[model samples]
Target: MLPRSWVAGARRPGPTPPAARRSRLYAHLFLWVMQSWLAMFYIGAGYAKLTQKHDLLALMMTWPAQVDTELLRVIGGIETALALFIVAPLMSWSLFRSVMLVGAAGLLADAGGMVVFHTLNGDIFLAAVNCVLLLMSLIILLGRWEWRDHAQLRNATS
Candidate 1:
């Protein structure tokens, strides 16, 4: 059997106790905050791309040049869609957990790519920003995965 400290830290893979539940609640709360932050951030980014304003001009003017207008809009649309994905889980939509997972995964990929892109463009600061975002997305992904695993374990036992 596990040691007491180990057991307490491990918790079981079944129904959550009060302390476990509290931790889960905190995780959910963090998820909500992340979801909100990512949704707003992406939505605004996508909006800027769609409208060809703000960062659009910068995108056109800067390192990765000659990005087509329509392309920008399409990228924005995808970003906005991902933002909606994050929001759905918050609203407790039936398929939202999966959707949020997918969104987080997508953002994780995006951030990782941006990190490389920025580094290649000699924009160390931008690369660092994306690296931070990548780590943040990763934290959300892992936390959500833990929660998902517990939920599935609970269901299977039930």
Candidate 2:
């Protein structure tokens, strides 16, 4: 949601322009909303994978049969960790943003793997879902990096 100046990697030695400030505000608001949805979705899915023994089988049925419960739990752990990173922004802003960048990258990779696996398993619908998640992860990763770089530059120049 950044204006042309900020998105273009603009750097100057003074207070941010009012327009740019507004742009930054909008960007943050948008990210907060999207991240909240992602965090909530993963929280539930992770919990199910980790603890819901009865439903785990049905929910994970799409996965290849070779993936045992232990491996499913491991996947759940990874999902939980990534979810925490996305939601960290709600706790400590500085730490959350930094950790989220890393988490989003991990999620991106995971989604890619899911896509490949789903496709190989003859499930285009599942692969499509993973593809959507992959795009979302990518947006978070790129957006976080762009904002981080811009803020660091702004702080340095100021």
Candidate 3:
């Protein structure tokens, strides 16, 4: 296994020369890809909710007693807004960060509800997928914020 020192040292900031900018660009491209994927997921989810299909309505019915159908629709609308914010160039970093944090929280709550639903219904696969998706969204949100902060710091120092 790799030494702990190596792992810790890997987190340290390094000199970013000219070529490093290209690497950063590539990293942003990768982030954009993930963002796009997340956006697509939200778009699909919003569409599903808007349609009020039988299956989706039934699934929403299974939501905890504390959460009402109107709340669920609002949540879906918020998700759709978040998905747009993440991909829209016109959105400021602060706005993006705010939306991302809110989105992450919503996703976590949604995942929790999914877990409860699946547990009650004995559908482990869907629960697992929801958990994984929630985790991934959290990771991406944090990573994007860190990347944005790092860039800001580098700009200030340079």
lDDT by residue for model 1 (15-90), tens: 6689988987998888778778877888887777777664546755473254566666777888888778767775
In model 2, the clashing pairs are: none
What TM-score does structure 2 among the candidates reach? 0.78
For all the candidates, what are their Cα RMSDs to the real structure? 7.1, 7.7, 9.5
Q: Considering lDDT, which of the candidate structures 1 and 3 is the better prediction for this target?
A: 1
Pick the TM-score winner.
Answer: 2
Q: How many backbone clashes does candidate 2 have?
A: 0
Cα displacement (Å) at residue 157, model 1: 16
* Better model by TM-score: candidate 1 vs candidate 3: 1
> Where does candidate 2 stray beyond 4 Å?
1-12, 54-56, 146-158
The residue-by-residue lDDT of candidate 3 on 23-131, one tens digit each, is 8798777766777777788777766655575455765655433456676677677667766765664367655666666665666566676677777777677678777
Overall lDDT per candidate, in order of appearance:
0.77, 0.80, 0.68
Measured with C-alpha atoms, the lDDT of residue 141 in candidate 1 is 79
lDDT of 2 by residue, 1-158 (tens): 87767666556669879999999899878877777777777777777788877354666665624577788888888988998898787778776778888788888998899999999989999899889888888877777676667898999999
Estimate the TM-score of every prediction.
Answer: 0.74, 0.78, 0.60
Q: Who wins the lDDT comparison?
A: 2
